[model samples]
Target chain A: MLINHPLLGPRDAAEFTCFGDASLLLRPDPGPNGEPDQAAMDAFHDYLHLRDNPAGTHQELWYHEQGDRSWLVVTRDTINHSIIKVELARNVKARNLKTREGAG
Target chain B: MRYSVFSILNQALRGNTGWKPVWREPEPRPAYDIIIVGGGGHGLATAYYLSNVYGITNVAVLEKGYLGSGNIGRNTTIIRSNYLLDGNEPFYEMSLKLWEGLEQDFNYNAMVSQRGVLNLYHSDGQRDAYARRGNAMILNGADAELIDQDRVRAMYPFLDFDNGRFPIQGGLLQRRGGSVRHDGVAWGYARGADSRGVDIIQHCEVQGFIMEGGTCVGVETSRGPIRANRVGVAAAGSSSRVMEQAGMRLPIESHVLQAFVSEGLKPIIPGVITYGAGHFYISQSDKGGLVFGGDIDGYNSYAQRGNLPILEHVCEGGMALMPAIGKARMVRSWGGIMDMSMDGSPIIDRTPIDGLYLNAGWCYGGFKATPASGYCFAHLLATGEPHDNAAAYRLDRFRSGAVIDEKGSGAQPNLH
Candidate 1:
């Protein structure tokens, strides 16, 4: 499988190290006072352990270890090794924050 | 028919045509007392124990494919009770004990081999860790021996002991640990359950749960709806998908674990040997092929095949352990989907949903845990209580901060 990096065209998947679900990017917040109450602990536990774990399309984090050293958010099919899209994780995080702010 | 010397002799005298199918291809009934999902080793064993021990013969084991089609037929076939944790040691030791008398108990020739399993340690720190684990095993009533480099060499002289990098210093041996015929386990359990009037239904895919309010009453299958008083899901890799149908989300990720077999050669490795420096375990099959495997492809995937990187990594580990293995041509390789849990341990307990039970999150170790997993799961279904051996395997442990993480790799499925 070749991951089409945003900076580098298409690199071998072996050159990249996968760090599982992109959901790890959205870690849960402890609270305003940073005290881990029951609700905060529950959210953190779910965030750490629970997963969608779908069999179809998945957005996962992949590091270009042997390549340009860029962390890319690769949208790939879990059933077949097909790369749908790849983008910079920083841009994805920024967009996520913007969406959350807009919703708030 | 009872499988014995008399049965073999009688079949031989009758020109070998008197043999019948070991299990029946029965149609699904309208209802059963209990329904077990996934006809893998664990599911079949659960049915076998339910009938033989619990007297719950009105059970049905539903399978998407044929029996033993999952990791039951895909693993490296190594069995051991060399666990370090208090939560996991007793459970696996129970499974190992069941494995010892499994063939005789089920009346089938499973070829259960009791050759020892050795885990080699390279560094002084590693040796100390193995010593601690050995003590833990002994405390848990399982046999363990910490052997030095010379003893390890005496057992297998072909090892790269004096190599510059990752030199073998010592090993932890479990004398009773070994391998079993993987498919024979599934077949024996299926036959045992079938003989006791349990329905073993193949090609019966469970589409969704027949839920009434918040309670699970039955299942909607590919054939039709089959009602049951209680439902136990023993699906290993497909746990998340199967439970999702019941409006439940599990802390599981499906990852592909690959295994390989080399061309048939003379017996060299007497028992299962593991490289502690790297992730590789190997054993010689009865058919002379060297069966071995390493870590799972560290990613969430439903694909039942792994990548070339892990394959190369496994071979490299094998070569590092024993250079002689570099000459053996790998004849076949296959992959199994593993249901990686957050705690790196299994869950065998009642789900929050009424009349629903879960026996999943076996990860890559489901094959070895088959008999005990079945026995405990059947106990739960029959008596509505977690068996003493599997009492700690609660579904709510993650929320309760009681995760039984043997590797101490918290919440990382791939790392486990």
Candidate 2:
């Protein structure tokens, strides 16, 4: 009888390729349903300050699932599926912090 | 093809849209009886065992991402019960038993193979260690056969068995030790648990934990807050981070570990070969790729991707033993994060915090310990007491210089 390969997992298992930064990468495959979920853009805006930028590096690829489970935005090349920069998909100022900072 | 971090960084610098979150709508839930923190193998299995065996329903396995997307999915899929620690020995051995009956238990074929595992030795001292381990295994009723060079050749002739460098002395053979279908283990648990009223909540992240009078009442999640009588943390790679959110400390270091698989080939390695002399081990995935891995990152890292040096060292050790492997093309490689404790043995005990329990510190052997760990952890949850065997793995042990040093290293590797 023929045996299947080890890497061949179930159909829905998230496929991943590793670059620099982070463990447990679980970013979802984009949906075919047309509209993108723009609800988490602010999360992508100020991720560098949250991630604190890796040593000697400025911009980083941060998929928020490591613990935040918020949103992770990464910049990549269209030609090659490479993660150039990653950040938390959500980066809203905390309500208390926003009030404390006198944003009003 | 998926995007690489390098090109993603380039695009980000050029005002290009890169790494962004794909958010899905949140699903509604009233409340769950038992809520498992991380939806890895142990979490899922606990849910299955909780509902199937204990008859307790209304369970929810909350995963920050899709199921089997964490360390459970990233592991090398090697399963063995060759641990030398107390409680750990019997515990892992029991997991091997559950693996033996998993197809019947979960009604899913996990593809468990008892193809045997050989721990190689280079020097007499190394050979002596295997003897001790082998003797221990025999004493514990495990099937361990000490084989000589001739015996090794008879079993596997393709191995470079001659007067080459790093000469092969002998090996400690665990005839029953082998591998299993890893992701299958995940799905089997998911299906079994789902069928028994266990709601597996995916794309849900647990934010800070909810503490009531120093007892963990429940958790505050990204979706919302959840209340539970008890909570378990089987979050392998994210153990430290998850615990941190609960206002606790864990004696664990997160490190990156990588596994590589070569292109398909004719049969070469018939069984799992562990090079005890170095951080090297290789096994042929049924798909024909030589799946192998090595030590954790020397430095602390939560990053799943490993450095080049470790990948080089692991492959070097493989090439040293199996020279024919030099021509084999490396098809793919990936890495996973591990919450490595000071000692390799895991900690399965109730914390000072009431109703909150920890089953972390799995090191590199989490896959092998899944069933036994889940059973024991479930017992801890139900009775609020650590089993007699697992009681020794307490947080205070790390403080009072009390430890069960199985490998006797007090800390990390050099475990045969």
Best by lDDT: 1
Candidate 1: tens digits of C-alpha lDDT, residues B126-189? 9999999999999999999999999999999999998788999989999999999999999999
The C-alpha RMSD of each candidate to the native structure, in angstroms, is: 1.4, 17.4
Q: Tens digits of per-residue lDDT for model 2 on B9-128?
A: 888897876644322233626466677889898898888888877777776778999989988898888777776656567777778888888877887668899999999888899888
Candidate with maximal TM-score: 1
For model 1, the superposed segments whose C-alpha errors exceed 4 Å read A32-39, B410-416
User: Ten residues in a row with the worst lDDT in model 1 chain B?
Assistant: B407-416
Candidate 2: deviation at residue B48, Å?
Answer: 1.5
Candidates' C-alpha lDDT: 0.91, 0.69
| Residue B327 Cα positional deviation in candidate 2, in Å, after optimal superposition | 1.0
Clashing pairs in 1: none
Compute the TM-score of each model's chain A versus the native chain A and list the values.
0.94, 0.25
